[model samples]
Target: MTGGPTLPALPPSLRAPLGLVAVLAALVVSVIGTLYAGHSQPGRVDRWIVSPTADPVGPPWRPVALTLDFLGEPAGSVLLVGVVVAVCLLLRRPRAAVLTVAGVALAVGTTTLLKQLVGRTIHGPDNLSYPSGHTTFFTALGLALALLATDRLGLGRTAGTSLVLCVALLAGAAMGWAEVALGAHYPTDALGGWCTALAVVPATAWLVDRAADRLESAGRPEPR
Candidate 1:
């Protein structure tokens, strides 16, 4: 409680936890916006990035999602985290490894819960199908990357860290877009994904980061 490893920021301190909560608050805005703007289905926010396969018969969201597909598969966003963790584990970063694995679980589990609890049917509206799972994974992975890639991982600024971030965002966006392209998810699904991610991802990441920080701080002896 006093001090612990933080998520995305050093934990052991209140600032980091507060910052994470604030960041997650963005999800609320996203959800509310989706409820208001979405016509019980995904809307055409072509202003933002979408897919390209928007044919006359298909859900317009498909083209929007397809358009957002970059580097092909949506897994691009999380691949960076895997690589980072691989390097970290090889380099002897136990904390980063645990957080990466746990974050993935947390993100995926939460998404499944949302899909079910929200009752957002697939293919069409009638349910809360605004948020996209692809988007959830994408955003969740990004949060994990930001949280897990700390001093323990040894990701130097001049080295792979920067590249990892760039790839993560681009990939997540692409994957999220792809959902719409396939007509599997609505545009709002992507939005809900982001909101859910921002809300839960940060909280879990912060909790995990605090645990790591606690261990780290414990290693340092106090000056008697």
Candidate 2:
């Protein structure tokens, strides 16, 4: 059977144990940062960062706050991920789809689990707030969409990747600012979320690529 359009493959040297190690290091650092900020006493990082924007109820900032809240909702995240996955499937990039789905799932699940384990509470709901779930979902989605654009869309890899990265960074930053400005989460929570995506997406993508390689190799007929 004919295969789908191939994505530009990163060298195995970059995608294997080295890449995995880097991703894991990022996760560890972010986890440590979140714990440090969350568990500190009064006047710690969380308080210092949150105190300034904790009261953003004024008329001027109301619209900005509302817009951010709307964008950060779970519905928005699901929609973004759904669209990306659909596009990847349409482009016959099953590996991309798998990576996207797995990255989002891993980021979201890990954030939720960490929140519960950390048990940190702040200005927002009683639910754990060590890491912002909205930030994690959006960031991961952005990264996945960026990859699809570069890999499947046939855009110049460097230019396309850079453009997408900029946009994604802006969106992620906006979400983080909104959450912090509205007192929904501490700044470190946003940081933790971003770091979580950086770690989870690459690791998930590497694993997906490896599995795909194995499946493809197995399906090939033996040489005469």
Give the number of the best model, judged by TM-score: 2
The candidate maximizing lDDT is 2
Taken over the whole model, the C-alpha lDDT of each candidate is 0.55, 0.68
Model 1 misses residue 52 by how many Å? 12
The TM-score between candidate 2 and the true structure equals 0.77
Q: For residues 165-224, write the lDDT of model 1, one tens digit per residue.
A: 454556456666576556656656666666666566546656766786778789899989
Off by over 4 Å in 2: 1-43, 47-54, 57-64, 152-168
Model 1 accuracy (lDDT, Cα): 0.55
Stretches of model 1 off by over 4 angstroms after superposition: 1-26, 33-40, 43-53, 56-84, 124-130, 147-169, 213-224
Given candidate 1, what's the lDDT at residue 207? Answer: 71
TM for every model, in the order presented, reads 0.59, 0.77
